[model samples]
Target chain A: MKKGIILVLVIVGLLVTTSFASVEKPVMGISLISYYNPFFLALRDGAKEALDEIGGTLLESDSQQDVAKQLAAIESFISRGVDVILLNAVDSEGVIPAVELANEAGIPVVTVDNDASGGDVEALVASDNVLAGKLCGEYLVEKLKNEDGVPAGNVVVLDALPVTGVLNRLQGFYSVIQEYPQIRIVSTQNAQGNRTDGFEVMENILLANSNIDAVFAINDPSALGALEAIDAAGRQDEMFIVSVDGAKEAMEAIKNGTSFEMTAAQLPTLIGKIGVETAMKVLNGEEVDRFIPVDVFSVTPENVDEFLEMATF
Target chain B: MNPFVSFLYKNKVTVAFVIIFIFFAIFIPNFLSLNNLMSVGKQIAVNGIIATGMTFVIITGGIDLSVGSLLAVAGVFCAMLVKSGVNSIVVILLTIGLGILIGLTNGLVITKLKIAPFITTLAMLSILRAFALGMSGGRSVSGLGDTFRFIGRGEIFSIPFPLFIMIVVFIIFGFILAQTKFGTHVYAIGENEDTSNILGLKVDKNKIIVYCISGGLAALASIIQTARLNSGQPLTGEGAELDAIAAVVIGGTDLNGGYGRIIGTVFGVAIMGMLTNGLILLNISFYYQLAVKGLVILFAVGVSRKK
Candidate 1:
């Protein structure tokens, strides 16, 4: 009983002092998707770097792919009166309640990588996923078409449903591919952008369709997984794979002569950096763009070396 | 007594499965194709194996909520060992052994410390998943070789290799449950623990061994899963325990534990897989499919209750 009392006392003291300490620095609370993904890790690092340069303090929380926890974090940030809020939503639509809570609290929100469908936000920084998908489509059209410029092949699409960003990529890819009537979509299944699901779903697809020429995955994990399935089926040579998300594994696969051919790389670090910069601007009573487009580029085997070098540092 | 009522009472689960299967096969395009059939078999193989073990536990009136976490643990162990160039045979044995050891711990805690089985296994679920995350540094372990993949993707006579494994596991366990004295004691203990103890049944020993079997089956399923993905994902099998339990209960196994059949669980797993496949083929949204699955489970269980 005595120990419990002392522990409570210490926590109370810390909370009181922390509240007072917040006045000196412009505090920004970041609710990230999760730090397990290397993409998100780089984003956090870039955000911290930008915040450090501006002499601002960053209070961060890992959502761990839970919207309830993100909402609680937002509520706590609001109660703590943080100057700005940065969010990487697990679900763009599921985050509206929390975003609205922050909006009601008069705390400016800078959504990074993912968007909030409802409630007002100071800025939204994300990759042009539609353009990224188009890039992949154009690359596939160039690489797989016959010398006569005719495109024709059986394609499988591994999708991650419920995420708006992934859906946009798929929409964009489909828009570009629909122009070629000969390029048939043999199957489209939800893999949840997970390596294991990707492998399993791709295997099932291969079972249903024996003549798959290419796979368009929503992310690199799915692409790598499909590559595994194709390799297991002894059809790696016949099947090519493309995806978004310039993950390290996809880069290594391309360099090592696997079936994964190309991926559209999103600048997560740049997105994070810009997220903090825009948050700081909001803190200073300066207006920022409602939508900020982070740059994305297609990475193929030819230029994977450059991206790999950048990744190392 | 009505003949139809008597038939439904005797074989409600199988009858329900047949009706659902026929409906999908007729209404859904390509649902009866050899390709689609094989895919369904492969998809349910992992859950089928785990649910078979779960049938044993439920028969003894116990639950093993840690099976899903155990899957991730075993999977991560396999991938790490393979990545380090360890022999595949050695890695497989060690992974299964780890699972047994963990299962033994859960059994002992519940039996020796007198904790409830639910609490013991629930705590195990949290600890095992956290251990997996820590062991893999919160990242997926990948880059396994081709030999590992064959266990998951290989086929014998046009049947998926995992499906064959699931069938073998069920046959062996089914025999043990129906024809062995130990199996009789397991049911007796579930029916009434005090009476079984008075009758000199080795209740504690049987419970421990049953849990060990559950762990071993989960580990086996994880090995196939890891091989199928060509990587050991720390987050794999996140909610597999619920699926296994659902299959067991839907197969006419009472949750209160005394009576259940492994063969019935097989039909249960098949029904669940067919539901997912049928919904996808019919172009239903994923969210609505979840509600449909829930409703089907309720209806199937309600029908079985008529027995």
Candidate 2:
């Protein structure tokens, strides 16, 4: 038994070592909230590209939206002695301890997309969420005005309350929509930031509010979900949908000229690229801004084709 | 040679764990480091706790899919209580109580209504998840205080607090499973429920208790998770039932019931935890990691099956 165990161990050791020989490089650890979403996947791709340009090794973990797993990944990053860390927080407040651990290790932490609530973060690289919301609000207003000759309609919001980013988008949308007294928000319900919830919530909203003229979803998945509900109810032409996140599906829907009129496209790739760049700067002892905001654009039928041509994720 | 091969087959789960550990220790940088191991322990604690409860239910020839949803609801409930300035002790007790209550309901429904455990728990899963979402407004309940965080984050003697909790739970459950009359009854029921019923074993009562243990332990896991995240999230623990089930199965626990050990489950959880930690250290892509995990699980379970 002992000899057999010894033989197996030797073979495994040899195979593993040869296959996973470590190379000396400036290692960067990235803990994504979850890679299931295309947006976060694109963000990871952007970071990978940036790291490759500098010949740095990038170690990435998908936290699967569980704060415990995310913390474990961050702790693993710290143990590996990575030069820097890029964090996409699953929960802004829940991630404080992880950021603090990075701080203690003297490793710079650059938060991408989602910001942490505590700890001495070197920088935060994220899209201007407020601007994304504002862009959506503007597009909604313009589209409503063009369709009805007045920026007046009963709108329902498929919102996600857990995400600070989504909340900021809502705030920006509310800031714009609240101004037009003629445009009333008939109902606002939480979609929990996914397509299934978005569809279910919108279905209930539709049952209650029959005269809904427009819907604003917090993200692409939810927007498409709301679109599904609208189409199911045979109210596609009666209402138009707008959302944030220039996801490929959202772009396709826009190009097809479905009820999904427009989406405020946040450049997750840019946020990721800037995140790596900022982490490098912090590593080099160079001064860096605490908050770096990427731009958001409006993806409408007029420009959806152009955006789709350049989309990588 | 035949005897040796039979022994290998019998102990395949341990062999798999040992091989994986050796591989990571040799190739993955810092895989054997104290900090890395501690983190892995912490990572597996939540699943480990739930798997402990799952073992009982599985040993009784049953499954509990609602553990995940029960965990989420318990977490959100605890978080709300903490936010409302409830004492940490009271919050923990109430959260665990809620878990037990849910488990009791699951047990009663399956027994009294003559429904299968699978169907009963599956329906409970949807109901509990919706309840959690409604209670938390589909948002994460954040800002749980430092005292509550200690349950997940605080350490005793340099080990993670959650890891400590997992170890204590394993010991208690392991002892119960191996040394108690209830444990013997569980195995008898799993082996042949009808025969055990004829033997006057209080079959229905035991089954209900087994499910209660599963639900209560699931709630216990939620406390650690909620404390670690420092928030109560309605969406947390989504698909966690699968992870716990995976661990229990990987530990060589017979899914059909009557044949498993807590020690095997422990090794199972360890193997999974090491795989996740080691893969990240090796810089493997997330997409490939999922594939590797699935294959390893299948290989471990497949090799251990009776010839």
Candidate 3:
């Protein structure tokens, strides 16, 4: 039995060496903030697929949503001398010094989904968050028109302050909503972009306002949370919710005809695919755009079913 | 000192609760409504359950910083088990057992190594959280069915199931602490460990049991929290231990131990819950809410001090 096991191990080792001997595989190191977000998981899967097709080995590390941990992962990537570094920074500014170190080590850095501030990052691949928010606002205005040929509603905004992406999305939504004079934003509260916070914040909002017509959540989790509160308050038929991030839960909510009406899909998998391709471009000394914007689209009850199959939880 | 001032110090938490409740009821619209009051009750139920156990540990003069992390672990495991078609009762027992085992490990180490509870539990906090993240692969364990949700979302006689659980925990633990021999030893150990040891009290055994209770309560709280959220998050109870500690302290429980009541913690949890709900109703920004909470904690600690 020992001899048989030894022979199998030798065969497996020979197969691995022979496969790698034909083509030199470029190594790509990925430092993600955390894998908790389904969006990030989709992103990782896309990057892995792209890298695999190119005969490149991917080294992945999770930073557990800590800036210091993310920096350490980047530092280790630099020490390992990988061909490229892909960073999904926990804190954009906090990641700059790590990006600088990578630059000093003569390794190219490609930031995906979030940018690193004050660094010569070779490229940044992120969804156009402002555009995403604008799409949702546009959809809401068109769908929420009254019989008097005007759009009007008292809206609650679920803000996740201190997150640049969320802020930008809100700003974009505000710009479009203000154009409709009859609509008014009744209250704004921070839900921190999580379902639990979203539910609590929404519950408080429900208590404060009795005539809320719509809700704009910074992300899908908050939107889903608001839906829960709406259901509990027995106001689901009256309240409408639009949010960013076409996450699986939101898509399910849409399919079920819940208060969640629309979601602006960030298409994280596409962003990841672009992220790896851009990293390879920089590694090959090919010209790549400093900022690459992945297009985002609005998902509604009308079109959400098409995305349900592809969405990751 | 005035007699009134002395009376106020003696009944600080209760007085504070009455004042805060009355203030919010008068100033905030719909604050006294049944639905809103129930909402606040449901929100604090998780904290209250964990704080009940925390009250025991704190009275015994030990801190369990690992409760929050243990909550996440229990919650994630429960969600995973439910997802894999495990029986709900068995899952509950297994998850809770895991928590007690971890707590036993904490107790054993602290007793054998003579380590400070603060330092030991702080280390356990990081270790437990890391284990949770590893087990869940940094993703939320979700898709739990309606039967599981009933624990968090269901209601009987218009009271949330979680609040009912919290009340039951408070009564059971409260009774044990106020009327049992184990409770007396816990107080003695917290007041003076060396003296308790000299008195031939099973100080180490009591401490271990206290920690195990804390761990078990945390697991129970996590089950309800997971049910309430409809998901098991790796980061579910992030910084929650602090909230439990704050609840105990604001209830006028001494950080130095041997000087508090579980009933005091009930009022403390209520105040914290109302404060949060009131701030939001007042249109306060989220940033300022943290500041207000900190100020309230300081004030509670101050008012509880003897002049």
Candidate 4:
């Protein structure tokens, strides 16, 4: 009984120190997609950075890439009396029940990076993934025009989730790549955004195809996976590798010459910071923009050293 | 006539292996090359190590679905420690200890709780998987030390270190399965648990030991896998339990328990290793590989049923 009382007092103390004029105590729940990805780790780091700035605690849960667990984490947050909740959903459509449950608990919800397909979220902050993809496609086009003078060759693509934001990025990248008359994709596979599988699947690809010109990975992990497999096959110098998601590790890969070409960077840290900031506004009885657009740019060997931290998008 | 059937039944694994070999050699040139065989052995090392422990448990009529999950946990822990700049020796010992805990838990759950090994290990499968995934924050613990990676990728006189480990584990397990009184107790329990119990075989104790052994072996697989990839991606061993069990069954273990052979599971593991590399070399589609794997499992089980 004493411990419980002390915990409650500590909770009250955390809430009373809010940056905004003294107001009702608030708590926030952070439920994220697969935490194994460094991208999500950066997202969590950003959220912690925000918590430090805003006097709130984060109850973080990983969905292990499962939609059901993502929902359960949200419901858990609601039951814990958090004033606000942030979601990085694995499946955007399947989170309605938990979102509605949080709303009933009088806690507003913000969707970060991954948009909630059906949830009535207070705010959604993420990169313009389409533009990010477009940027990669544009970069590839320029590379082909300047170096090769043509876009005719064998290419392998590793697409991310078959849904939503990732699908949007794929579509945008595909839309641009289609303009190249001679560029042909010899093979495309799914690694589910996991590095190990990416490595294995890419190994199989490398074994089967000896004449590949380039590889397009959906994210930095997959790109790195391809690079590892290529390195294993002793073909690191032969194939050009490009990807989205300029994560810090991927930038390091670029700087080290392990990875070829570039990545379309997404600011995971900024997403975390702004998602929390927007949640605070909603908590303060103020309306915030539903969709906040963050900038996306290409990171290559030329600028990787100077932009490693920012690469953790 | 019955002798012929029995003979065919007794050497089913060998027959299947031969058949696959003949088919691959005929269809794909260079399929039987020495380099390819080395690659196959190296590939089989992962599941071969896991199967060593599993054979012990199966000999006692028990199952271990948590083997794959335990592998993931051990790999993740070992990798995380290494990446955090911990000494390699400490990281290796810590990983081995974690494996022991997983095995101990499996044993306690089965023996103390008197739970069916199937369901108990099955639940463990999901739990340990979830726990490992959570611990790593769902990220890959990468950038391991080169010497640490040597266990998986190192070669001893042109032989992959992992394959070498698999052979050593097999020799050790083979000794236990063939020589020790515990081996006899395990087979006795599998053959007739009630009879073994009445015979003062300490059936429950034997059962617990087998589970622990299985966990330890699974951890060994994780070590090899981690060394191979040089990173402990939390999700690395997903769906691998099915492969381990499949290899055990394919090698000629009775699913209903009572009999298991370490050499048999090695052949089973070898066959699987051959299949993956074979298919990749032949450039078979992913869908075909999945179908062929299922068909192979069915064939192995069907052959075992004839016994």
Cα lDDT tens digits for candidate 4, B274-301 = 7766654443533475688889989987
Which residue ranges in model 4 land beyond 4 Å of their true spot?
A: A1-313, B2-6
lDDT by residue for model 3 (B174-248), tens: 999999999899889889999999999999999999899999889998888777655576766777899899999
Number of the top DockQ candidate: 2
Question: Pick by TM-score: which candidate is best?
Answer: 2
Candidate 1: stretches off by over 4 Å: A1-313
lDDT of each: 0.82, 0.88, 0.82, 0.77
iRMSD (1 decimal) for each model: 21.0, 3.1, 23.8, 24.1
Using Cα atoms, each model's DockQ against the true complex is 0.02, 0.45, 0.01, 0.01
Off by over 4 Å in 2: A1-24, A136-163, A170-243, A253-262, A300-302
TM-score of each: 0.54, 0.87, 0.53, 0.53
| Clash pairs detected, candidate 2 | none
TM-score of 1: 0.54
In model 4, pairs of residues that clash are: A35-B137, A35-B138, A36-B137, A36-B138, A36-B139, A266-A313, A268-A313
lDDT tens string, model 2, B1-307?
5999888888888889989998888777778888788888998999999999999999999999999998899999999999999998998899999999999999999989989999999999999999999998877888876878688778998889999999999999999999999999999999999999999999999999999999899999999989887888887888889988899999999999989899999988998888888898888999998899999889878877765
lDDT of 4 by residue, A174-217 (tens): 89989887777888888878788789999999888879877888
